[model samples]
Target: MPSRVLAVYDGSGIDGDLYTRVNRWAQSAPHWLDELIKVWSAFGLGLFAVFMVLAWWRARGADSAVMARVLASPVVVVVAYGVNSVFKGAVEEIRPCAQIHGSVALETCPGTGDWSFPSNHSVIAFAAAASLWFVDRRLGWVAGLFAALMAASRVWVGVHYPHDVAAGALVGLLVAVVLTPLAGRCGPLVDRMRAGALRPLLGAGELPLVGHGHSAYRAQQY
Candidate 1:
């Protein structure tokens, strides 16, 4: 069945070409808003880094045995990105904002491929968020909502269509559900590792606790 989104794009109602709209938006890309987006994106990255530092901090003085589990959980985040990348490559669906929209908003776009299938943003964010959950369930749920907001924001901004958001949200949720649990199971072992050699690192912890009680990253994970 052809996607109704596709049908909408194919609809004859589009009054102008995407390029024309993009050109128009380019004329008014507010300096502050553009800066805001860049800042938010950067903030998210910063938060993620903070989390990793904290993760290491906690298990710093723990037993080496827990290292495997603790490390594996976060490593799963890497795998999550790989999975999302594969799916993104597989689906070349154009971004909704770029498709049949009479005018494309250039400021909202990266001037990249309109291929907005399952949102990579959604998938990757959830992956990292979910991975953290295994360490702390409350944090996990919070991260899920956080990730969801980010995904929804993409759609709200007109860069992604409703279906694009839907697909991305769905994929992200699926990844969280499947991969996160495995990471959580490593909790005890991770705790053990944190108590041993990793302890010195935590005892001597210098890096700012990004946000969470344990670490900046875990409480306010990207």
Candidate 2:
């Protein structure tokens, strides 16, 4: 992944300099700023899950297409995270802070073997962002902005290099772009499951009406 990203950037001597500048900023930043970055990174890790569930909850019973995308959110997140983990395992690239000297990371370096080729936080964030976007453009844009912030926070905390987060974001976006359409393709399956035993659990109940024919319109549209 790093090699591919480097290729994409044509070895433009920027990755290293970017890392150095970001790390330097992290080192010299005010204490409160460091604390905020740390908090943001930690919050970023959980924020996607919150957004995904909220999206699913809000889409209950309206627009089958939207619900389908919402339902697919978990699958997108899991698959993207799994792919990121596989890359981490295969590459086993040491964390930037561990490799660079005089790197004052805001957060403690993870224990050895915590490979850092691509940023998991970025992967999950972008995956959720894409999923949310598929369901609703407005919400998707908001989530996408948050995803960008989360990616930056990973770099700000000195846990991920720019390339790492960039690759991760790309991986996540690709996964969503490829798989979100499954929501539309799997319309029959989602419809079948609507009245199944897990209906209550999945919140397969009627949602607040939108425009005319809300639920009826969704059924026919999807």
Q: What TM-score against the true fold does each predicted structure earn?
A: 0.59, 0.81
| Model 2 worst lDDT window (10 residues) | 4-13
**Residue-wise lDDT of candidate 1 within 10-99, one digit each (tens)?**
311332243344335534678676456545543553455455456555654433433343465556666666666666566565555565
Task: Give candidate 1 misplaced runs (Cα > 4 Å).
Answer: 1-38, 41-43, 55-70, 103-114, 184-222
Off by over 4 Å in 2: 1-14, 196-222
Residues 88-190, candidate 2: write the lDDT tens digits: 8766777777777777678888766887768899999998899888887888898999999999999889887898899899999999988987765765566
lDDT measured at residue 11 in model 2 versus the true structure, 0 to 100: 18
Candidate topping lDDT: 2
Report residue 85 deviation for candidate 1 (angstroms): 2.1
How many clashing residue pairs are found in candidate 1?
26
